[model samples]
Target: MSNVKDTTKANNQLIYAKRNMWTGILFGFGIVAFIDEAVFHQLLHWHHFYDKSTTEIGLVSDGLFHAFSFFATIGSSFLLADLHRRHAFWLKRWIGGIFLGAGVFQLYDGIIQHKLMRLHQIRYHVDVFPYDLVWNITAVIMIVIGIVLLYRTQS
Candidate 1:
């Protein structure tokens, strides 16, 4: 029947849209990670922005690991969003909450560990102030926005 055919076409279009959206988000995250790890770390010698001493390099490495973890979390969020479209409600909600919680924790860590304690510095800055509040704030804002968008789309 024509009605059945029309319904199938619409369902296929919805799936295609969701797939494209998630792919785009993952691609954007990859670009950001590439810039941070490759251009900033290797080419510029910026390495964690401060704590340049040999002993402090370990701490810097930890920070890099944390950064990578954040990206991985976002990728997982995309997967959850896709699953949600396929009727996996509980799984989607759990992943959404996890993403939101991780974003909040990262913001707090940036403030306390990096800014208050002066554990690291923002690169290319002449000032002794190690913490770049601007960068931290922008990161938090982006994370929150992404989480909100994901939640809305899933709902």
Candidate 2:
């Protein structure tokens, strides 16, 4: 009976942690996307979400991307609230998820979007090497930090 109870408890903990982490990941991704879109795309006029075509098309793409970010943010917030209400939210695990998500998003934008898809550059007409290096390295660092945090939580 004791062993069975312990196993059930452990399983519940695992499930809670997983949920918290995933919620945090969504939050992080949405926040970063919002920042990138607002600062670089909108504020700085650096580039759009999709810059391969006319400005009008780019604006439309940006609007769609903004909508995605908004939905992700709201969805994650609701999830987090539910976890909190259930008293199952794990702060450390959630933090780890946040870092992981942000890093993953940034890396994807830097490599796949900026380079592979030719969607947009960090900046235009200027030397892009420094920008690319900084962007990629920062993303790697964030990912490492997130992984370390998540690993530690497992113990």
lDDT of 2: 0.89
Q: Model 2 residue 104 lDDT?
A: 94
Query: Model 1, range 1-155, lDDT digits (tens) per residue?
Result: 99986676456435554453444445445444455556555566655534646646745774675476567647756765665565433433343344444445446546774668765554545763434565566557757765775566552
Off by over 4 Å in 1: 1-35, 49-52, 55-109, 128-131
Choose the strongest candidate by TM-score.
Answer: 2
TM-score of candidate 1 versus the correct structure, residues matched by position:
0.45
Q: How many residue pairs clash in all the candidates, one count each?
A: 0, 0
Q: In lDDT terms, how accurate is model 1?
A: 0.54
> Tens-digit lDDT track for model 2 on 1-155?
99986676456557798887899889889988999999999999999999999999999999999998999999999999898776667788889999999999999999999999999999999999999999999888988888998998883
TM-score of each: 0.45, 0.90
